[model samples]
Target: MRRLGDLEAEIMDRLWTWDRPATVREIVDDLNRTRPLAYTTVMTVADILHRKGMLRREKSGRAWSYRPACTREAYSAALMRDVLGESPNPGGALAHLVEQLTPEELAALRSALDSVDRGAPGDGPR
Candidate 1:
């Protein structure tokens, strides 16, 4: 998956955190609580995200309501997949990643792998 820009990320963050469809105005209002941003800018970026297949939008009265097309976890997994796919030493890279994990995280990874092998869902990473 393609990485998001600052504005694209900021917009997606709000939509994912809210876990619901929201208008560009709603996102702009929430973002404005901390920083000054133009509504048109957000609207344009939201449209861009929609075009990128990162967001799904529908007409809501006079405005468009947007939501993330994939879950945050799904996005992270895609990034990880992209990294591993591009690496010349994928196994070595994965081993290095595993070496950096905490004991708890390692256990979670083991459990998730085992669950997958068993065709069941495990408690996700911590």
Candidate 2:
């Protein structure tokens, strides 16, 4: 997976948050805090997402209702995979991934891993 643009990621965020399929108008409404998006602009972005396999759409009267193609975690994992694939050493790649985390994030990761070793699920997936 390639890096998503800001608008694309925002749309995906909206999709993932929705419990039901949303029309372009609904997505635009959610995003309106940033700017006033025209209906056609929202529709265009949604359509692009569908073509990229990042959105699922169903007929909703005249327009389509769109939802996430996958959960947010899955999409993030895909992006991580794409980025990590370019690294020369898997171990070094993992180290680099760890290095970017804030202290709190690193601690959370350690705590989660400890729980995993104790035969438990903790902190949930990213």
Candidate 3:
């Protein structure tokens, strides 16, 4: 997946957190509460995200409604995989990531691995 720009990340964050489809106008209004942003600018970024397959869009009256194509966790996992793939020492990189994890996170990772080992779902890692 292509990395999101500042605006794209902000929009995706809202969609993921809201867990619902939203129009550009709604997003622009929400964003304006924290920072000034134009409706057209957000519409353009949302279109880009749709083109990148990061977001799904549909017509909502005269406007387009957008939602993330994948869950945040899935998107994050793909990003991690991409980073690891780019590393010359993927194992070392992974080890370094593990080393940085908190105790609870480490335990969750271990549990997720164990679950995978048992042919169970790997939902415990996150």
Tell me the lDDT of candidate 3.
0.83
In model 1, the number of clashes is 0
Off by over 4 Å in 3: 1-4, 82-126
Give the lowest summed-lDDT range of ten residues in model 1.
Answer: 91-100
Which pairs of residues collide in model 2? Answer: none
For residue 46, give model 3's deviation from the true position in Å. 0.5
In order, the Cα lDDT scores of the candidates are 0.82, 0.76, 0.83
Ranking of all predicted structures according to TM-score, beginning with the best and ending with the worst: 1, 3, 2
Per-model clash counts, in order, read 0, 0, 0
Model 1 residue runs over 4 Å out of place are 1-4, 85-126
Candidate 1, clashing residue pairs?
none
Candidate 2 regions off by >4 Å?
Answer: 1-4, 81-126
Two-way lDDT contest, 2 vs 3, winner: 3
- Assess every candidate by TM-score: 0.64, 0.60, 0.63
RMSD of each: 10.6, 10.2, 10.6
**Model 3, residue 2: C-alpha shift (Å):** 14
Residues 10-94, candidate 2: write the lDDT tens digits.
8887777766789888888878977877778778878888999989999999989998878888868977775655453555544
Model 1 C-alpha lDDT versus the unseen true structure: 0.82
